[model samples]
Each structure stands twice: as C-alpha cells, then as structure tokens.
Target: MTPRVAVFLDYQNVHLSARTAFLPSGSSGRHGHVDPMRVARRIVRGRRFDGELATVRVYRGRPSPDHQPVAARASDRQADRWSRDSRVVLVRRQLRYPKAWPAEPAQEKGIDVALAVDLVRLACEGAYDVGVLFSRDTDLVPALETVRDLGCHVEVASWKGTSRLRFPDSQLPWCHYLDADDYAACRDYTDYTAA
Candidate 1:
C-alpha cells in the first residue's frame, strides 16, 4: 500500500527561510510565498516510497489588525484561499504585539507548540503513515522525535542552503532539501498586498 503523507507547515518559518534562500536581497515578505498544496504535492512526489498526500496542516500566527491593518487583511485573504482546498487544514493563532507598536515586530507565540502537538497527536491517532515537517525551527525537534518513537515515519524539508532539524540519534530523520527550481515551482505569485 502506498504510504499516506501528512505535511505540517510552520508558515512563517518556511516563508522566511524560503525568502532567505531563494528571493533577491531586500525582497518583501510577499515575494517568496508558496502555496501550501503545491509544496505538499512537490514533497510527496520527491519521496521514494510513492506516498499519497493525505493532508497539509498549516500553522501560522495571524497578524494584529490594530498594529498592521494592511498585513492583517492580506493574511486573512491568504488564509481564506489556502484553506479552500479540501486537504488543507489551516490553524492560526493571535500574534503577540509589542508594547512599542510599530517600533517592534509582532511575534508568533504558540504556533510551534500547536504544530508540535498536532504532529505527535496525529501520529498517535494513526492519521497518516508518514509526517513531513516543513520548518527549520529547532523547537520542533522533540515533537518529531516523539512521533518517530511512536513508529510514525517522519521527515524534514528545508530550502537549499538552509539548516534543518536534526535528530540526536545520527542517521535517523531523513531530510528533503528543496532547491531554487523546486521553490520556483511552488511559488504563489498572488500579491495579497494589492487591493
């Protein structure tokens, strides 16, 4: 039987990483954006086991409307579009704003924990045969380890030239390094910022 693959995406992490790896210097945040379904399909196709894409779980922090109205609207539109796909599940948490407002950036408070929780929980529930995480955030390493311990096959994906989460036990947790061409294929060119 072909393995069922669930893709877990830490949206901000992957977005920033892809921007760093593939976009031109000084490009805006909107430039390197990727369509979640496109990336999930690309990842599934890259696997040697002939996996079927079961779902794409996207974890992201919603922008604060009071602090950044334009960004908040753009984010809402993007979320609506991404979640329209039947296989995509988008989970968004409120972003933490700084006391100084525009002087400092809003941060993602609980996204990693949420993603980690689902990663382990889904593995235990037998939601998919394989879990592919697309984030370079090391905070997720423990969750990946936990899922692997539960007998769920797990893998990590990162843009070329970027770091990926590593397992303590050497040789475990294979990684798929997507290069510029792969990034190009998954790019979402929609300028969400445009009115």
Candidate 2:
C-alpha cells in the first residue's frame, strides 16, 4: 500500500531561504514567490509515496499594502490551480503584533503556531500515514515528536543551501529531513512561472 502523505509548508521561512540562498541577487521576483503547488508535486513525486495525496497545505499571510498587487495575484493563481489539480489547500492568516513591544524587535505572527496546532491535531486524529513539514524551525520539535510517537512518519523538507542553519538531528532524531534543492532539480521553473 502507498503511504498517505500530507504536506505542511512554512511559507515565510521557505520563501526567505529561497530568496537568500537560491535566487540570484537583485532578481525581480520575491524570494518565496515559488509556486506552492509545483513544490508540493515535486515533493510527492520525490518521496514516491504509495497512496493518493490526501492534502497539500501551503501556509502564508497576505502581502503588505506596499507590495505590488501583481505578486499577490500570482500567488493566488498558483494556489487556485493547485487546489483544482491536486486538492492543495491554501491557508492564509494575518500578521499580528504583540502588545508592549520592544523597540526594533522583529515582528512575529502567522503560520508557526497554527501549523504546530494543526500538526498535533492531525497526528492525534490519525489523518495521514506520513506528515511532511517544509520548515527547519526548532520550535516544531515537540510537535514533531508527538506525531512520530503516534506512529506517523514526520519528514522535514528544507533547502540544502541552508544546511548550516537546518534543524539539528539532536532535536528530532526520528524525523527525516529532505533537501528541497534535490527536489527542485526535477522541476522546470518555466512551467510554473507566471507570465
């Protein structure tokens, strides 16, 4: 029997890493501007999972008003296409600021907590045979462990370019980390590029 796989992506981190590590400096497109559906397909194919793909959820936030509208449109289009073709789900959350913030502190909000909560819930509910996480945040170690203990395989997907900053095995020994670069090798950028 084929393994039933569900993929959860941390949109911001993956986007930043791709921009800083993969794309050339001074490029026009935003760093995480990749087609989530394409990435999902690449991952599923790469893993050679046996069962039908149950879900591919890409988590992201709305763009700031300052960003060009075209970018958001492209993202939505890609998401819609994925939803139609492969049951890909797009989760959008707003960025929020904490009260009594320190001066010059980085803003934090969106997906991380949501992803963690969903991962635990899904694992406990036995939603899928395997869970694929496209992020390297150590914050997820607890959730990863919980899922693994529940008899679900948790695989980490991240770019090889940031191998130095990738999650250490000491954090979650049972989980497997997949290099996104290796998966990207099989994709054709032109096919997913928005005209």
What lDDT is obtained when candidate 1 is compared to the true structure?
A: 0.92
lDDT against true structure, model 2: 0.65
Write down the RMSD of candidate 2 (Cα, Å).
Answer: 4.7
lDDT of each: 0.92, 0.65
User: Which pairs clash in the backbone of model 2?
Assistant: 2-50, 2-51, 15-32
Worst 10 residues of 1 by lDDT: 164-173
lDDT of 1 at 108: 93
Best by lDDT: 1
- Write one digit per residue (lDDT tens) for candidate 1, span 95-185: 9998886688789999999999999999999999999999988889999999988999999999989998889757558888899999999
Model 2 per-residue lDDT tens digits across residues 52-171: 567887777754323435545655555666578556777876444345433433243757888888988988887888888887677876787788778888776766657422234564
Q: How many clashes (backbone N, Cα, C below 3 Å) per candidate? A: 0, 3
| Root-mean-square deviation (CA) per prediction | 1.0, 4.7
Q: Who wins the TM-score comparison? A: 1
